[model samples]
Target: MKKRICVLAMLSLCWGVTDATAAGPDLDGYVEFGGRLFDVDGDEAKFNEYRDIDNGVYGNVDILSYWEGGYYIDFLAENIAYDDQAYWLNGGRFGSLKYLLYYDEIIHNITEDALTPYDGIGSDTLVGTGETEPALWNSFDYKKEREKYGGDVEYAFENGYFVQFGASNMESSGVMPYGGTSSAEFPAPIDWEENQFNITGGYRAKKLTASLTGQFINFDNEDDSLTRDDTIGSLPPDNDVAKVLGKMVWRPEYYGSVVALNAGYSKTESDEQLGIVVPGETRNFDGEITKWHVNGSWKFEPIEDLDLKLLARYDDRDNDSTVLTTLDGNENENYSSEIFKTGIEADYKLSRNNRIDGGYHYLNKDYEGRSDSDGADDNLFFIQARNYSLEDVELRAKYSFLTRSGDYTVEPGETDEGYRSYDVADQDRNQVELEGGYYGVEDLGLDLEFTWFNADYDDTEVGLVELDHYDLYFSGTWAIQSNVNTGFYVGFERDYSEDLGDAAETTYYTYAAGLNIEAYFMAEKLRLYAGWDWAESDGKSEFDSADIIDTDEVEDFTQHILSLKGTYFIDEAWSVTLGYVYEEWDYSDDQWNNYVIVVPGSRGDTFLSGAYDDQDYEGHTGYLSVKYKF
Candidate 1:
């Protein structure tokens, strides 16, 4: 709605000149106010569309100020009642002539509840009625909003050299819930705008440092395609990209040797290309793309504790397109890719506490597309060891290995269920990691991490097969000396993969855990806090069809979070805070398991009823805030 009335007239002219800081602030920075409450329940748990479970009343502030002479201003706000929001405002000028201005707004609520029967939801074409037909199925919430304005400036020189420039403008409006097609994925319609410009120049010495850069970007699409609440497609056009960059770091000896260099170049195109081109097409899509890269590094310490390093990199890409025809004489084939890398690393100090490190890397890639991502070439090796002489206890170990050789090129009725053998394969990879910690109480500390990964293309004949990963983590913290402190954390992750063809064959994994605690007593002006977190994700896919037969599609989610806090001071500038937050989410999906409204036709189990069940929710939030310093 006119961008929410121009953001409510810029927040009512910035809260009508700061609403007299609610009766405070007579010059030196400081102002805050608050009131918050929220109660939520299941069903798409506000899914990010702000609304976070129907909350109410929230006003809190954190500001930075200076107002006179050195001019300054800043405001930061977070989670202000629903729609998952965060806002920021800025003002500048401090010292050696500086300048700044900024504004930000964000809102995203992906799915409060999704279900559609196409009834022109947000216009631009939508009409449904295909097979099985039963119609009337409404329930939508998939939203997005972003608005931004920017500014920047920097200048410093006394011979140390420095210069910078910046620009920005962004606008986005949306309702893209994974836009339809590939078998009916619904909800799509977005307006866009973006503009960017940049500049930089630098030189710092004490052993050299240099920089140079330039950039320009543009993308504007106020709706130009998409049609599939019923059918019609072809979108994403209106593009522009340009870049130039350079960097260098050289140390001629001020404690040794170091050299670094980086380079870049870029180009992307779209002058006018957004669709419809019937008749020996010259353009339906010939979108241009170009790229370039260069990197270099060298470090030295040929002796001493024994240290040395060197690395090199090169990359290239080009697809300056122009050959898009088909109206009886097909013509379209343009591709390119190139990459080369080299590396070497070393560090040795078998004394002090023992140490060892090693590295070797090599990569080369060249492609012409089709068959997933063409081919691949790689070789990597690593070794590590460290022992902190075990007083507070500390040890580390690491190992890595990799080998891959390509050979893939599928195109000619691309089958295997439309393959994705990216980087062809003849693979073999292995990794092991371990980290340590133990700072024998002074404040207390203990941490450990473990990881193992393996990959084998199970006798590749094209695409996926056997991949495994595992991880374990532990954390600890404690302090009782000055007031109080506490902490705990746990984590585990595992993933497995296997491949054999199309339609389905997927596996997923994720796990998380956390805990936190805080304490401070009277002498410290009172304070207490608590936190807990847990996460889960699961997935299983196994569908192989040629007209229905086998099945096994499942997706899941589980989450829980809790937080509590208390603070008191009311002196030394003032302080007051009380907060509580609780959250829960449980979700399941057999790919949008039944919600009745019928629309199945061009194949069996059309996503069970067309996905979007991301439901289940619980919420509670309470707040009272006050903090100031002026």
Candidate 2:
């Protein structure tokens, strides 16, 4: 509330300044006033999941003013009285100096119907109740709020040099569900903030350009631990990062050649206090990680209708965390990784409307102090063809193949038995894609796309075995006249994966489809618009083993959205608009539908019904607004 008040006061002051100093033909902008009403049938949280779209009054203001010396100011404020509000202000001269200020707020609504059996919720400490009755529990909502404010400035010199600086701070606070020591769940408090700063300088010339940047970031958490039912758990710790980056691009005066280079280095560190300490161990832990990368590319045209490019990169990460020798009698693993990659590509024009492209790439990764395999290497090859020889028609097709090999030998005492990590497993992947577009019909346009992908991990005995994906999409648009148009799009997708385990061999599948249609009509005095969209998805998991049984559908969902609006121009300087929106959602999950709130015994598991329940809703909204331009 204090933030909102400050924003209002600032806006008022700006208006006062404008009224006092503005002369004729020096000011121009628009202001809009509006109000919205909502009618909902189900949970409100589902309707306003990541935004604040409730019944309220809203206003928007935009102003632009300039002086005779190439100086100007631009300001905009939106959703003035709502939770999802934003404000921006910027001023500068033409190609000389510029500054900016901005602020925004967002609300994340998790759930509005949740029940708990603990006292002192949303605090550091919580008390337990022996009773396991569901009717006697307390009800509360789970949500969070995030706010950010920032500003930046830039200055340019006449000698092809420029500098920019920026800073921002963000804070988040709320309560969310977390699992406790036992089978019970609790709502935990959250309070954290992050601050970031960066500065950059660059030089621009006709043949060469270069830039360098330095950045620093810090993060803090107010509550480091929580106590529930005689058990204490540690939360997120304080951390910070500092980094520097540089980039350069140079162009030679021969054969349209170019060269580019980039490099960066960063380090992150964290400190935390231990909740439970041994007799001979320290009370705190300090951890650090460092990373660096360098990459470069060169492109040149060797002859007529031929172009070639080469690129390469190297990356490294080092982890140096505190060892727990005094407490556990074992040293911590470094868990570091390094990567090197190189690639070459070529493009040739068969004719004025025909072209072909091909590329080959190789990558290798190495790991230290890992229980899994040591590392993996990959090789990829691809080719593409495009043609625009037919009048008003275009076509494109591409194919790619890749292979991966890893060292799967396990160490005797350090590795898990009969386990293979997928990240370093032996695999083969293939993909194919095709796209086409036609504009031969007068005032009509059409496009179509299709894709297929497959991955086989045949060498592994107890991990992912196979994966497949497919997609198809189509869209079309028709322009009946200069001021009238309509368009529609549709898409279909499917994904499948198969895995092997000790007890059962499981396969998971998902399928989805979506459609959208839109129309616009412009008249002499009134304009009209309409849009509609619908989507549906379904998922299933099956187990094929001697001792396990398959199950029914795991999840299903559907959504629909419709909107209509019209604007009536009373005159050149004033207009009014009326709009309506409708949204419907239907969702279901098999696990949540059969879950029990509390078990009967003292040693049984307990749960809060509100934390993971399904949401189904239908909502309607209407708004009216008037705008004036000067």
Candidate 3:
């Protein structure tokens, strides 16, 4: 009710200003409550329905408090209450001796639409039906709220400097999912608002340090459910950004050494509404972007276990020029682009058991916005090794390489002196890894690892393909007595594919296993754990030949999981937790049998492909909390 009477009038104005400032020293904080439950199974009906409280529950409640002293006043609060009862509050603070203020608020009362299939349209329908879809009952109960307030006041001197000015006001509203309605029962356009501002300066020394800051952001969404006033015809529009930065550091103790320098610049203006089609629609003008950088490092020992090092960096960018339109308004303006980069690194310590390292990098780019005058270049390399043996064993290895080439532009008034020129694709990549370990059992333990990868691409881009990979792993652990502990692991992975217009190549593999156990009763506040996992996969494609391109069959899937977790310490301010999970999925590919369906005008919404063809899923969770400290 009126947010619990504004959190009891800010906790009675923070205890009436701490009993009229009884001379400092008094701090307090408290409050918490919780809830969560989720159960899901795959094979359609949108992936096991929960369309908002059809029995399954989701609940929560929370209220927070805080206070501090020494420099006078400080207090904070956060509130949240839900279970469809709806409530929100995010926190704020106020300071004394003159002035200082802060504020933050977020009120969300989302009417469970099964949490909108977990955002981003159920991850684009699990990348187009690799499964998961279902949950749209009524589908239009959404509420969003916002409140932001800021403050700053400065006047300090002890031998340091400070200056400040800050301001903020942000107000937001319900259901604005960018895009005109399609379906899901519309009714959400509760108006909108946004605002921001800042200014700052600082300096400190014992060696050297400095700072400066600035910011501005504003927005006014004139109804129409947040920005859509005639799509690109503007109304209460906004977009502006500005930046500046500088830094420096130097240390010299009779030339023992340290040095640093940094710089920055930025500018931006908007109102094009995000567009990029490079053949007709290309928006992002009202431009200005610039950048620069530099770096340095050094260290020395020149003895003992031996040590050495070095490093470097550089970068750049620029753009500005407008006029590009589409969405049936058609207009264009000559474009632009540019980029550059550099790098270097090193390390060594060939003793006390040996060590080595490496690095290298470079990149370049230039293109007069689309009409082709393109450019490209990239390169990298690396190496590493280490060993320490006398029987307790330990070894490691690594290798890496990368390469690239340039020139590309296709379609859109084809340029670069035309003639259909758009070929400058070349790439090569390689990687290797190896590892070994031993801890001379006294508690029993072991580990092993191996990896390899390769990639090649040249003058080809249609579905661009070429890659090879491999991996292997093994692990072990045991202490079957010290409060009990155990572990196991196994893994294998492989993938090979090549198809540059029917050069045809395919291969796939996946296998895994895991197990873990742990226990430690009373003497450790109580603890328990369990884990198990398994996985499998295999490959081929070409269905309905629309220029033949389909792969992913021979899929044998298996999954089984069981877990029970616990923690209890009902004494030092209270604590309690319990968890249980069970999972099952097994499928013998028949291309998933076209994923059974029957919910278009529901007859009790059906889609049970054998309920996951070997189904068995269950989940139960529990929590009890009570905390208090002052």
Best by lDDT: 2
Report the CA-based lDDT of candidate 1 relative to the real structure: 0.70
Which residue pairs in candidate 3 have backbone atoms (N, alpha carbon, C) closer than 3 angstroms, thus clashing? 46-133, 46-134
- The most accurate candidate by TM-score is 2
With candidate 1 superimposed using the best TM-score fit, by how many Å does residue 391's alpha carbon deviate from the native? 86
Ranking by lDDT: 2, 1, 3
Q: Alpha carbon lDDT of residue 120, candidate 1?
A: 69
Off by over 4 Å in 2: 1-21, 24-29, 67-69, 180-183, 274-283, 324-332, 409-419, 501-522, 546-549, 599-606
- Model 1, span 328-369: residue lDDT tens: 787756778888899999988989998999889998888774
Candidate 1 worst ten-residue window by lDDT = 274-283
lDDT of 2 by residue, 52-96 (tens): 887778889888877788887777888886778888888789888
Model 3: residues with Cα > 4 Å off, grouped in runs? 1-103, 108-141, 145-151, 156-162, 165-175, 180-197, 200-240, 243-321, 327-329, 332-630
Candidate with better lDDT, 1 vs 2: 2
Tens digits of lDDT, candidate 3, 172-289: 6555333222212222354556666766666656565566666666665644212111222212335565666665555555334445555666565555334232323323445444
